[model samples]
Target: MIKEKAKKKWDLTRKMLEITDDEYNGVTQEDANLRFIKTKLQIAVYYLRMLDEHNCEYEVPWNKEQFKWLLRKPAGDTKKQKAKDWCHQCCLIRDKACASWSYEEATA
Candidate 1:
């Protein structure tokens, strides 16, 4: 289920742009274009970092391209606040689920 979501995202991101898998694998969510990556593990990290930045309530934008980690400040820096907030909320959900599903994670 999670993998399908990632593949869909990756396919969309790649539809208009091109990315190599290795480069895709290397970036953290801190990258401005982090949303562009389509892999489960990498995307998970990207969202987690977005949550952290949001939880800390940043004033600056920190957007990046996945492979090089090259970044640009988010435009208007307006959505940054909202994205950060949402990401944080998502993090809480993910964390809670992970904690409750220790049996599955432990085995993996």
Candidate 2:
């Protein structure tokens, strides 16, 4: 049930990535892409959090290092730096979720 909900949210987010130019109004392409990336990160973190909540031991496809790299690479400009920081925050939250999952499993 949680997986299904996450999958639906993921699908909806992907669909949102296909919105038309007019849909963006005054937002630039770079900003739009950053928003998309942030949304994707949020979705990934949400699933990890859900996994922790359910005490699921399934492997997560992406690691904290990958998320850290994604968070740090695109920090060239102010806007990009904001996006990078946002990704970094997501990474921190995700790491906590995974760690909590591991701790719970170990203590169980």
Best by TM-score: 2
Top lDDT hit: 2
lDDT of 1 by residue, 30-72 (tens): 3434333223324444554443433433222323443223222
lDDT for each candidate structure:
0.40, 0.53
User: Candidate 2: deviation at residue 17, Å?
Assistant: 3.7
Candidate 1 local accuracy as lDDT?
0.40
Q: Model 1, which residues run further than 4 Å from truth?
A: 2-6, 9-74, 103-108
Clashes of 1: 4
- Candidate 2 clashing pairs, residues 3+ apart or interchain: none
RMSD of each: 11.0, 10.7
TM-score of 1: 0.34
